[model samples]
Target: MVSITFHGGVGEVGGNRILIEDGDVKLWLDFGRSFTAERRFYAGWLQPRGHSQLMDLLEFDLIPPLRGLYAQHHLEGSPIPYEEAHYDAVFISHAHADHVDYVRFLDSSIPIYCGSGTKLFLEASETVGHMDYGEHLYKTFRTGDRIRIGDVEVEPIHVDHSIPAAYGFIIHTSSGSIVYTGDLRRHGPKGEMTEEFLEAAAEAEPEALIIEGTKIDEEEGGLSEGEVYEGVLRVLREAEGKPVFYTQNRRDTDRFRTFYEAAKASGRRLVITTWTAHLLSKLVKDEHLDLPDPMRDEDIAVYFRRKRSGKYREQDYYHWERPYLERKVTAEEIRRRPGEYLVCLELHHFPELIDIKPRGGHYIYSMSEHMEEEALEEELMRNWLSHFSLRLHQLHASGHMGRRELLEAVELINPRRVYPIHTEHPELYRRLLRGRRVENPERGRSYHL
Candidate 1:
């Protein structure tokens, strides 16, 4: 028998941990953190201890307390004895924090599998101090590759999402084929990839389907990637030669491309942060992404803030960051030629506004609205904009399928049993996918397939 257990992602938006056990062979789909649960106990600087991260999280049941799953270092002083990994492998769907952050606590011996592009994102993020996933024997695969472990043969297929190189999986277990849709969209720039995945999934005739319902509760229609580009282009045109600032997820290459093209069309050079410049440099290796090389692209400029000595010294920045300094654009340059640049700025970098001093510029919020925990941050952001006399433009395109498209995809896949995770309202799937076995999974409960 093939049994699956839900350790997290039960009636929640993230923290997706699904364990599949077939005979003696066990594997994990995704080992993401529970943002909602973490926020409940910790906030701001009051985070888990660095040395005892696993223990602190397990104290509140934030992570699953499974034997032989965590690294020995993380279990240094814990009551649980450390041992070699019992699981065969872990397959990451994408590099999103909600889907891949907690891998740091896992035993190093357990091999982790992900798309080659996802590995690039992870390495870039680690280099920039954004995340620390610790050490692991990583193995990368692409769309057509098939990975075999014990009795399971997993096939990963590319899917259209906000981030590049995202994928869904078709797991061939002893019982039957199980399909897992790791957060996908049908209207993004790579929509055809999603169509291909759906076609293949339907062809497999899987026994179980695990899907994400991030946007299922909302009634609003999702904007296609083209619509987003057009909306942003209109904003750039309306800016009237003022330095328009925008911010989005750092890993979202599609959105970055949208902004890059829009800026080019408007005859403005796109200015990105040093971290973005480094990420782009790494992503250029993937030809399919078609991103601009920040170092060589004349239309792109890297923004560097004065740090440490306050003289923009070479030693102040990391070695990886120093390479992009040749294309650096300081605040004063942007202040003098505001009209010539479309700058990428986030809330943390709002301090630069005092230096740039754009009295009446427009700020484009290219990402989604703030989560409930980010209420105070939003208010602080407004204060900064108000003080700078800047106008806020909330123009964004979601990275998930909307209500109609999500339902349609589910019907088209036509799996025997539909299990919905990664949503607040899992019950909605029962009503939406009528005449289908929609399982509202309970946390920590095992279901036989």
Candidate 2:
């Protein structure tokens, strides 16, 4: 018997995760944080939102502290997994914290299957000094590579999302095939790779298909990520002075290029911080999406800023350091004539500049809700962006698959019993896959097939 259970990421965006089982062998798709919803719940430690609306924005299955998945550590001798859940593998689609951050809590022996880029970013050796992880066996496979663990033979078909080396997997079991789209977007520098992977999945004709529904609203429209880049470029051009683009990390190299070209043409500096520089270096692996170490000229001054404290020591710089060519600046630099500089910063950095400018510049809120407080405690959020005054535009694009692409992928794969695992809009997927046998399984409630 084969079974698939939706552990989280249903009826909500982000937090795409599930557990798929073929008899005794169990494997998890992705275990991401509920992010926005989780912060509001764990307010003190997380976002610290003050009585903000509940952030049950995304749903997750496992209980807190992650003991359920680890099969160890019980609270006051309560009911635990009778069988002690042991997964053969945990496959992560990309680097987005939602899918990868929770892995540290799981059992270390479970082998992790992911594309090369995903592994590169997770492992500390690739980025500056290595970060932390829970206990999990790390294994890497390329786009077309396959690996076996017990009865399951998994093939990673490369797909594009917001990040590099994102993928959907083809899991072969005794019963049939299960194609799980970890997370994906239709347009990027190497969009053809994602299309090819989807095309082949259609050819393989899997028994079941699981996909993401990040952009389910009717308003998302038909614009591809590439199309969004074009539109966002138009927005950048409207800026009369140095254009500062606050965005998520290096995944959107294509979009960055558009900004870079615009900045270069306008004879402005294309400044990037040390952290973003490191991320940029890893993404250049795809030949078609290459961005050389940014060279800052007199007109193109790339200002680099280090935190006042020494959280990231200078000695920690890695192999990519040569390319960054970074020069550190102080908070005072940002307050100087806002039009004279184009500075990029994430939400946390906003507080540092609060003393310098009190709202004249613009803020483009990029990235997912997973990173920020449900609402930045007014003082912290306002203080950060206060120094700079001006307009705020949310022209950022998505890194997850939209409703249409998910539908096309499902139709192409032609699964026998399609399960919409990670979506707030499983209904949309349901509407699109009218003729297919679809099941929306609940967490912990196992149904045998």
Minimal lDDT window, size 10, model 1 = 368-377
User: How do all models score by TM-score?
Assistant: 0.97, 0.78
For model 1, how does the per-residue alpha-carbon lDDT over 369-437 read when each residue is reduced to its tens digit?
Answer: 522223247788888888887888876677788778878888888888988998998999999777889
Q: Give the local distance difference test score of model 2.
A: 0.61
Model 1 segments more than 4 A misplaced: 370-376
TM-score of 2: 0.78
Query: What TM-score, to 2 decimals, does candidate 1 have?
Result: 0.97
lDDT of all predictions, in order shown? 0.88, 0.61
Query: Given candidate 1, what's the lDDT at residue 367?
Result: 81
Best by TM-score: 1
